[model samples]
Target: MNPLYQIFVDPFVQMAGAPDLFAQTIWEGFVGGMLYALIALGYVLIFKASGVFNFAQGIMMVFAALTLVGLHEMGVHAYIALLLTLGVMYLLAVGVERAVLRPLVNQPDIILFMATFGLTYLLIGAGELVFGGNPKTMIAKELGLPSGGIDFNILGGLVSLQRIDIAAAVIASILVAGLAAFFQYTRVGRALRAVADDHQAALSVGISLNEIWVVVWFAAGVVALATGVMWGARSNVSFALQIVALKALPVLILGGFTSVPGAIVGGLVVGIGEKLGEFYWGPLLGGGIESWLAYVIALAFLLFRPHGLFGEKIIERI
Candidate 1:
């Protein structure tokens, strides 16, 4: 057996030999991919309304999780904490509208983007100051989420999948579907699409830019909350998971910035592609290649389709 043949071709043969591994990997990929798409949802909403790239979306996810956990530590019941977090998010939406969006209403787009970068630092500091900068275990039992595993037995071996992972996948599907329907069928959604095209034209039509901005950012906060919940269920809730939200940036790159459907599709592609590449080719690169593989795919997409899979081509006549 030639070493090159074994190194290069063996995995394909092995994949055919063990279909179960492939199935398991794809399942894991889909769940993780949906989580990434959830974060992308927040980015898309904010970008669509005000054209500000909300760099704080990930930190918002962290802040939401910290709000939930901090309430629990204060002896509040989980359900109450959950409801209170919703209220906090609403207040956050209002504050952002009054404090940030209002003053910067007519500023250049780059300035608005920088403002969000500042908001990111603000959220990080606030979350750490309130939550003590330590990882906290998700109160899965307290929340009454499922805590069982499903087992697949084949050839005298068992591979088990957690029920909570299944639940998270189901919830993500619902969120994505609901978001798509809103943007397609609802009045506010239509207004958001209008604003995404041209803020001045939207305003000319009597669309309230401030109102829409608040609504869109609140929608983003809801997405952040839902995402924090599911990811928290998987591991300890911490600020670190927010960095994983940053992974959604490449997803946004592959998907059009304003496309809900593209987020779903691009997230699945990145998730499954990275997992497959790492499993099959990681040893060749000394392993740990999955960390940067998503960016590699995004770079390839940039070279081929800078506007992304669903983005419209920008035609500038100079």
Candidate 2:
């Protein structure tokens, strides 16, 4: 085959020839994208409410998961461990508000960003000291998350789906929907948006900045816990999962840092685009395309639409 033809034409032909594989790939991408959106949602929650990009959100997911597993290892029931984990995250939010954020109020954005970096290391060291630096299993069975795979025959081929992935999709969808409704319909949520829009304006109107900061951070922690549970069940609960969580950066860039629904759409684009690229073009590029394809797509979006698909453009007058 000619090089150009093989590069472009052959992949489409292969997709047509194997429709089942194409469908299966799409399903897998959707599941993976949902997980990425879950992680990105953590970032969005904090950025929207506090106007600070949280660098520690990824590590928070690992720490939350480790806390749950650590508690369970200490003989706590799974559900109890979950509740305790939430409590721990709540305490963490309070601690951050007191020790990190409160003192730094009115500081430059870079100062707050750097503060989260310190918080990330603090959590890592504490997690290591408390949970030990070993990978642990997520108590999925005890937590009542389903296991096993379902197979479907279509277009003369078999496509297998994992029950856990389906659950993750459903749970993530509910979370995004619930959060959207909360932000749209609730008074507190409106307050949060008010703060996100203008801190001074919100305070002038009687919105408590301190209280709102605590609420957003706690909400981000809740999101981290959910992301940790789903990702941990799919793989081992380990600090290495933080690396995967970093993919949310590209998701954020594609969706816009402040847009909630943008995270979902961006994640789906990254997820589906990468899977299709790797499956079709990997052999052409000598494989390993899955790892970098997302960044490439993000770079393209940056060049064309810097504010992202759903992000509102900011204009300033000098």
Candidate 3:
């Protein structure tokens, strides 16, 4: 009856004896992880185009969800409302390009980062003013999304799984795959990569930096829409949900800022690691340790591998 053994060893032993619970835990992790990657990808899109980190991605998710709900309330059918939302995002992108990126071309990285912070607050104010700062139920069934449960019997026990979560996993996987392929194979994707490498170089080659920024930001808007819908489908759409998007920071840390596959792998690692850690090792530190476990992992990773699990290190010679 060692207290140390009881805290760590016994819990894992208990987990070993419960296969269904383990599967359920893993399922939860995968779903949460994918959502993190989705948000991180939004950041990646912005960073790739402008070489600046965007802090407003979380609010973009909130704004996208709010727009969908607002459109739905205004008598637009879900499909048309979604299309309209895309248009809204598209307009927002174009406006940002014309007003922000065009003016800030060749600005310092810190200035661009500050600009994104301003954009974040602008979005928050806009979303609150427009959406009323209330949590709204997701248009799950109305949007033709599925809802049900799966039953698994293991170790003489039962585990229930949500069908919506399954759909989220598949959709997330397809999204990541499509994005990877697009970036790897398409002309626009190559343009995006070139832009990421060097804005001046791309511009020298007759590439329009403003145009690429607009396109990339619009693409991020599309991602925000998709992420918002799935997220809203799981819970009420609100500013609070935007807070969850902050989890992408840790994912970014774990996966490296510039690596797409790193985002996915890092998200999954953080998601699963935090969940498992909370369940097994968290109690030893009291309880409810899930709130900041990802950060702790990120800090540890930073100490050991500052570039992140998949990030590349660059040496700049002055």
Q: Estimate every model's Cα lDDT from 0 to 1.
A: 0.86, 0.92, 0.86
The residue-level lDDT of candidate 2 at 40 comes to 92
Q: In what order do the candidates fall by lDDT, top score first?
A: 2, 1, 3
Model 1 agreement with the true structure over 53-146: per-residue lDDT tens digits: 8999998988998898889889999999989999999899999989988998889988988998888888889888878889988877787789
Best by the TM-score measure: 2
**Least well predicted 10-residue stretch by lDDT in candidate 2:** 308-317
Taking the tens digit of each residue's C-alpha lDDT, what string does model 2 give over 118-228? 999999999999999999999899999999999998788999999999999999999998888988999999999999999999999999999999889999999999999
Task: Give me candidate 1's TM-score against the actual structure.
Answer: 0.94
**lDDT for each residue of candidate 3 in 127-174, tens digit (9 for 90 to 100):** 999879889877878788789998878657787888888888888888
Clashes per candidate, residues 3 or more apart or on different chains:
0, 0, 0
Kindly report which residue stretches of model 2 are placed more than 4 angstroms away from their true locations once superposed: none
Better of 1 and 2 by TM-score: 2
